[model samples]
Target: MAFGIMMLFVAILCAIAVIREVKERNFLAVGFAGISFLVFGWFSVMTIFVSGAPEM
Candidate 1:
C-alpha cells in the first residue's frame, strides 16, 4: 500500500513538471518529462507485481 502511494505521488509530480514545461513551450523538456512519466510508471508497476524468475 505504501509503495503504491509513493508511485502515485511520483506520478503526480511528473505530471506537474510536464504541465509546466508545456506551458513554457519547451518541447525538449516536455518530451523528457513525458518519457520520465512513462518509465517511472512502468517500472513502478513492473517491480511491484513481478513474477518469479524462470529456472535456468
Candidate 2:
C-alpha cells in the first residue's frame, strides 16, 4: 500500500510534467513525460489489484 502510494505520487508528478510540457509546446518533453506517466500509472494500478495480504 505504501509503495503504491509513493508510485502514485510519482505518477502524478509525471502527469503534471506532461501537462506543462504540452502547454509549452515541447513535443519531445511531452512524449517522455507521457511515457513516464503510463509506466508509473500501470505499476500503481497493478499494485492495487495484487496486494501482499493473504486471502481467507
Candidate 3:
C-alpha cells in the first residue's frame, strides 16, 4: 500500500513533467515523461487494487 502511494505520487509528477515538456516542445522529454506516467500510473493503480488502501 505504501509502495502504491509512492508510485502514485511519482506518476503524478511524471504527468506534470509531460505537460511541461509538451508546452516546451521537447518531444523526447515528453515521450519519456508520458511513458513514465502511463507505466507508473498503471502499476500504482493495480498495486493498490490488489493490496488495498492503507488505513487512514
Candidate 4:
C-alpha cells in the first residue's frame, strides 16, 4: 500500500512532466515521461486494487 501510494505520486509527477515536455515540443522526453506514467500508474492502480483500500 505504501509502495502503491508512492508510485501513484511518482506517476502524477510523470504525467505533469509529460505535459511540460509536450508543451516544449520535446518528443523524446515526452515519450519517456509518458512511458513512466503508464507503467507507474498501472502498477499503483493494480497494487491498490489487489490490496484493497483501508476502511475509515
Quote the positional error of residue 55 for candidate 4 in Å.
12
Summing lDDT over every window of 10 consecutive residues in candidate 4, give the lowest-scoring window.
Answer: 47-56
RMSD of 1: 4.7
lDDT of each: 0.77, 0.91, 0.96, 0.96
Give the better candidate number (2 or 3) by TM-score: 3
Candidate 1 — which pairs collide? none
TM-score of 4: 0.91
**Candidate 3, 1-56: lDDT as tens digits:** 89999999999999999999999999999999999999999999999998995657
Q: Runs in model 1 with CA error above 4 Å?
A: 1-5, 51-56
Total backbone collisions, model 3: 0
- Ranked candidates (lDDT, high to low): 4, 3, 2, 1
Ranking by TM-score: 3, 4, 2, 1
CA shift at 28, candidate 1, in angstroms? Answer: 0.7
Candidate 3: segments with Cα more than 4 A from true spot: 53-56
